[model samples]
Target: MVQYNEWMKDVNDDAKLSSLSVPGTHNSAACHVALPSVQCQGASVTDQLNHGVRFLDIRCAKLFLASGDDANDLQVIHGKFPVKIPFPLKLAKVLDEVYAFLQSHGSETVIVSLKQEGQDTWDNDSDEFPKVIWENYVRPHQDQWYLGSGIPRLGDTRGKAVLFRRFGVKDEQLSQNLGIDAHWWTYNTTDDDRGEIRVQDFCELNDTNDVQKKSDYVKQLTSQAIQYNATNPADPKLFLNFCSGSNFFNPECWPEKIAQCMSDANIQDCFGKGCGIVVLDYSEKDDYKLVKELVDKNF
Candidate 1:
């Protein structure tokens, strides 16, 4: 049996972060009570981390208030709605949780994929999004982060959080130090090869009938990652295969519904395979079978 909290301890330090199989949660911090369309995850960040989830998909929005108090603060959100109801969840709090987890589990490294979402209310042209992240969140805790542009070895990021930046930076110097450069890619794609990373983020489902297509795409990507690693052991590109989708208006095709369909799809074939970082929705279902399967691959 594998220990979820410290599974990385058994992995070789020389292994590249891109070459190993990793479990991840999509919209990771959206565990609070919210509308079905907004809430994508069930387990909290700490719970996910404790259950072998190493990658996190965090979407942040700039909260520019009328009074300008805490204007620089970033709120965790999903689409247009705040992830946590009654009280807003801040990026600072999420980082605190990650830092605490890393402090106790020194052998583990968390990959945080931060995307700037919900910019309809504010001007998107303003480069304040990346600036705020760099100045307020990252720079203050520089020592705890792996701010490199290339894929890192497991040893280099054991006790730190690796940044998978999804937003662009205006300043050239700041951009260089903003960790892995995954700023842009083809949206709603099944597969888009970008040299360093190959992504399969086909999120929008036209109807419930499209669920099977989504599942097939996920399985195909998983097999591709495994094959890529076998042939290119020396230098493997990260495969971010997302097993999540939704049909916005159709209640039958919401995130949970899609997750259930994905769960039923024979994912056992992916076990013990190099599936890169498999990002999922509602990862706590079926006693965390998905997380366990992905983590067991590393051992």
Candidate 2:
């Protein structure tokens, strides 16, 4: 059996990050969530990393512990649901695992799309909000990250996590001062601009959409993102396509089911040679074949 690891080592250092077919997981830390509707991934961060997942969609928040002793530095969450490790661990622990994995596999670079979830907000009114995050997560682990704003090559970030912030700490200057402005993007599609990395997060809101419809939607978004990267060429535009969706009203929108539908629909063939960052759900099953399918497109 082949022990697949450090696949990105095959890619040249001059190859643009935008040109790589990055396999990512949406709500990557939500595997511990008990609810079927909210859980997005079936693999732990380390497992996903071993499975050739290069991008991680991490949602975090500073929260009070269950014992009410003190707030954890950061907790990986999925909307209102709290995902925990065996006994429970902070977001920092998960990141440590990612860091260790990269350290062991020197040729692999990981993209961490870090976003704030829950009631926490990076507002100017409360300076402590962003301050706590910096002092705890960013400051302590600064050395393990690539904070550059530009799209870096694989060699530039190997054995490191490239930070893609999704929260606004303050005004333009203030956010920059807080170090939150380095390669950040608007929260949603409505606020998206063509100049920065564009994202498509289309999901079935009412579950009225059938499996075929949702599959087609994923294909359309995937194709457009690949085309965008092709035409932009020189521009460092990245297209993040979210292949995860859910509907509280219908179990059909569950992530596992959606992933199955995608696999059955043969959508992987539509990804072509450059699909940018393709984030998926339920990627742990089938030896993470879905993620491998996307990564294979880079060749």
Candidate 3:
């Protein structure tokens, strides 16, 4: 039996990372938040990794502490005050989990799509943000992180969190454009979508109660992903399709509900060959069935 955690170890290293079907979690650390719409995940980082989720969508903010010292650490945040994480210790805890997982599973690599949020007091200072990230997070643990921009080989990034920075850059040298915007779009941005690894964030639920309509949208996107990946088998590209949504007014379009739509057996069958990296919400529930299906497709 294949180990649930180290499934990526079986993937061929010669193949480009972009070509493989990786399961990602959007707002991966939002499990602790109390709000309805912003909470995208239900599992901790270690649990998600153990469940075969190779990609992680992390949103962070630089928070200033009250001790006259700014604790340059990254705090996970979704929206403004209400949806933000309560304390700074959470980031440390999460990183500890990531480090432990990678140390044990040297053959697997994780992708962290990092974006900045919340009120940044250092907006006036151009170099502070990147410096904070470098000094606090990336520099001390440089060996454990894959800091490059372009898609990397699986072997090179093994046992590391390949940083995909989505935050603003003051120091270009800090990330080397590795943290480029993920090119997230709605349902109609199909024309401009062209890349070796394409991503679509079509989680807009106009009508919160319309479950059937949301399901149809998810099905349509998955079908398109199948066709997109099939176009070039020899040199396949990634299709990051998001199965997450939010509606402040109606809890029906919450992250869990959106994930349920993607959980259908018919939808899972669409990725029999592969579905690139399917980012989901509320992935900790349902025994991580959706993520397991994606990982199984890799082998």
Candidate 4:
């Protein structure tokens, strides 16, 4: 029951820990152990003076350099949603890890909160929209660029990323001191400059002629590279599933198509693309089921 709220309390915490990551602690030749870290909220803090440290942030982390005015300030870290601990020990360990982690990353503020209802908070990534655009638009550009011009395709590096999680929260009046929003968690790929093709985009009313044209173009491009093909990827009767939507979610709508495509392409990690895939299951103190459904539906 150490009240780490007292800054001094953290002094005697881990002696060998204090100089951690410093020249005294981290030697290039030093043999670091393989133990995992204890994450406070989502940040990994030091436990027993650091043998290991890392946590799964939103798979597609919103990585932008810190801005001015706040430039001197640490990158403020806050949950876009919420997370909670059923056990005190678990929470305490995470706190310990977060403390150590702050120094490692220049993050200024780290907020822990409870999950909320009716908000979009998941990243269901798939390849339909961009596939449509790429097959039709980008491919043509590539061909023309190669044939008689000089232009660079920016690729998917535009930072159009995604993140998603399922969690719960309690319902209460705002002023009641309810510990609801204090621990919400989310990995933010919130917006995009790159035209990130979303799952919803695939549902848009595309012209039948355009779809056929693009489909035909795709067939021509991959025909020699891939001898086999699937035209009606999503024939109403089939259902497909995967552990992740990868960096996007449009694929969920036509799961069978993706599975078939992956098998054809011989991808090692079919759903593991973009940043990295991690499923974090944390909750708040409230109606678990209802909150989760609301969050899932809205997000």
Per-candidate TM-scores read: 0.96, 0.87, 0.85, 0.19
Using TM-score as the measure, the top candidate is 1
lDDT tens digits, residue span 1-299, model 4: 32212212222222111011110010111112211111212122242112221122221111124343222211112222122222112222333344444444321112221112222222324422223222432244332211111111212101111111112223233212221111222232221111111111111212332333322322332231111113321211111111111212243323223223323333222221111111111211122221122112111
The digit string of per-residue lDDT tens for model 2 on 1-299 reads 22346788888887878788888898887888466777787778898988888889888776644423246467777776666643444788888888899889988888887777776544446655456666677778787887776677777888888877766565454455342142344433322445647666666545635667766766886787688777876776676777777776688778888887778888787786677888888887688877887777777
Residue 299 local lDDT, model 3: 71
In every candidate, how many clashes are there? 0, 0, 1, 31
**For residues 1-299, could you state the per-residue lDDT of candidate 1 as single tens digits?**
79999999999899998889999999999999877798988889999999999999999986635234375688899987889877788989999999999999999999999998875354445666777788899999999999999999999999999999998776788788999988778999999998989999999998978898999999989989999988898876999999989877998888898899998887657655577999999999998988998988887
lDDT winner, 2 or 3? 2
Model 1 weakest lDDT span, ten residues long: 63-72
**lDDT for model 2:** 0.72
Q: Which regions of candidate 2 fall more than 4 Å away from where they truly are? A: 1-3, 65-69, 85-88, 120-124, 171-174, 177-193, 208-211
What lDDT score goes with residue 56 in model 3?
A: 85
C-alpha displacement of 283 in model 1, angstroms? 0.5
All-Cα superposition RMSD per candidate: 1.5, 3.2, 3.1, 22.8
Query: On lDDT, who's better, 3 or 4?
Result: 3
In the predicted model 2, the residue pairs found to clash are none
